[model samples]
Target: MQWNDYRLVLAVARARKLPEAAEALGLTVSTMFRRIERIEELMERPVFHRERGIYTPNEVGDELCRAAEQMEQAAFAAERKVLGSSSLVSGTLIVTSSEVLGAFFLSRHLTDLASYHPGLDVQLHSGNEVLSLAHREADVALRSSRPMDSSLFGRKLSDIHWAVYGDAKSSARLSASSDFRHERFVGFSSSPFADHMSAIQRTVFPDGIVSLSSNSLVLTASSAQKGAGLAVLPMVLGEQWPGLFRLTEPIEQIAGELWIVCHQDMQNNPRVRLAFDALISGIERDRSLFVGDSV
Candidate 1:
């Protein structure tokens, strides 16, 4: 029930090694061992099991760890509320979103917000994986799709469109069939839009070869800029990479909604609220750039 106990448990859960966790927390290995013993004694059960010198959490430990995480988040929220009620917004705000948005859309906005609220310290996590709000992985998330969690509150930022882009030199060689039948394609691995893109590619170039495939948008964009093949990159990416040109004229437009999501409980925290507004306003201001026929 103590914060120190929870910290020890969480650290152990993360490192999966007593010595590593002890070292991270600046505690002796013997002290960590005693703390674990006391925690287990107080709880009246063993939380972890050891096998071949490797320690792993048991079901009880896992459940307790989950509860501990929630408790820690609640405590942090309380501290934020007490500090926030005093006037200005100031604290660490963790925000996450897709890499494309993180790199392009969030770039200038984050810079501006820092200037506007110098007291506020913002942490940005940009990746493809959906960080869980329920698990307190992030304070706010800007994503192309909304999660199914009903406990979270979200609002639409804007609708984003896609385009088939390539280097100008490669674009010049492309033939405009209604379906873009002659263009080569570059695909990202495990794309959320894979099925849709597959159908579009099949409908367009039934026989064209797929020149490059990857999970990295940066790599895909770079390859497209090198005149490797056509890549359906975000308009923002095209703008970021001047060498890249729109290949499919009208740009293979895909209407995907951008959402700002946060746990209902954390939404009211001052730092969290400031970040939410900043994100929404930033996206709205750049709305026009995200849409239209081309970059």
Candidate 2:
């Protein structure tokens, strides 16, 4: 019936739970419930089937949700266009990166950038999930892979090198022999890089044991630091950990490319451009760190 109604239907359909949807929209569960009832009354028909705290959208709701999505996209595009036209290096800039990268590397550069520009507000979102530039979820992204979307512009930073890391004792022991079949390892529980590393490990040391696994590389590295097992970690991270030592040379087969990307429309915005250039320059200065040459 209206934009707000459309949004309510979309949120319900997406969240499937009233409380969750309400939280997303900054509304109380009771208020969300009342609003939905009011919407149905106005429409003179039921839009959702409720059961067991889950809301399933009916046909009428589905149509409204589709329209809501289109409106949302249009609104995002308009916002991007308006922001893109601004030439001043002021306003909020959201940058997303993997937790390890953000904590260990990008944070300093971004901090310096923000300090240099008093008007710039920098927000760093560190997670493994890739935020969508088209949806305006993030302004810039420092990611392990290049951008595949044509609407986004990307610059290749460097090839992220990986190596086997372990505690000093483990490193010494592993270094003494070429045989790794008896070694225990800390491996990733998920991600494409995790799968690739796992395959490499299987091929290289089929009998090696995966003693621990975690979704976060930071956790995997921590496990290795505690002598749980050897870990295959990015060289940048491995070199920085106090107790961990590289047990082997960089693994060429499992190398991942790093890229900094943003929506094409945001490239011209002064703040975005400045932040983008700062990141590129910062990463370039430490290029050896990423590629394992620094070690």
Candidate 3:
């Protein structure tokens, strides 16, 4: 009947363990049991099917759970909306970006922003896959290229250059010559950049001696460091290790247009605005890093 009681049913059904759900809600196990019993009494029907001390949502319970989830989201969104209207530049902002840039660049910038506005909190979704802003999956996107979604808007920050990299010791012998036929490359396992990386591979490693592929940029970097072979890496991330050597100038075909994107509705939200400005300011300050000019 009550919102908090609905939350209890949802939590319990989701977790499937009374103790775990109670622990999450900061309530004792006995209290959780009583609350569930009370909810059943008020509804005049069983919400969960109990078997072997595990709770599974029945048909009636499943419908209630869905409603409870929406209610919870609405409550949180309302709280965020109220905070966004306040003068204080603070609230939770979920940002998505590629692991390499998110970890190497944006993370530092977001940390600085957090330090400046102590109330601001950031949830970073770092990976090779891009999240859709229209789905409310992310508040902002620090990514290469503008979104195709017409409802989204963004500003180009800088150019991200890519280059071939290899181990400092072994790569000393690398050249874009017949010898290239003998070389190996570490490439992306699963990424939107897969086709782009393949294009780079065809140009430099024409022999197609790709030794291994991974989904993680860090692993790719490490592979290059250990002489696994040459790798196409973002200039900013590749230059982090002295043991890795840039084999050539920025690869034009693999170059990326960096942008900060958000939904149209979020354009005027104060917290999102502050965070967006911070990203732009930070990228402008370190523009050279993106273009392989500084490192």
TM-score against truth, every candidate: 0.80, 0.93, 0.74
Query: What is the Cα-based TM-score of model 1?
Result: 0.80
> Mind giving the per-residue lDDT tens digits that candidate 1 earns over 111-207?
5666788887888999878887766678788878866788788888877776777788776666444355556878766777667766765655576
RMSD of 2: 2.0
Clashes of 2: 0
lDDT of 2 by residue, 140-228 (tens): 88888888889998889889988888998887776734567778988777765678778887876688899888887888899999989
Candidate number with greatest lDDT = 2
Give the number of the best model, judged by TM-score: 2
Q: For candidate 3, lDDT tens digit of each residue in 1-295? A: 9899879989998899999999989999999999888989998999999999999999989988999989987875665455445666676878888888887887878877677878788788888676867557788898688667887878898888888788876555764332456578887767666777777778766885888997777889988899888888888788775688877777777788888988776677777887788888898777766787522
Model with the higher TM-score, candidate 1 or 2 = 2
Among all windows of 10 consecutive residues in model 1, the one with the lowest summed lDDT is: 174-183
Q: What ranking emerges by TM-score with the best candidate at the front?
A: 2, 1, 3
lDDT for model 2 comes to 0.85
Instruction: Give Cα distance to truth, residue 274, candidate 2, Å.
Output: 1.8
Whole-model lDDT per candidate: 0.76, 0.85, 0.80
Clashing pairs in 2: none
* Model 1: how far residue 132 lies from native, Å: 3.8
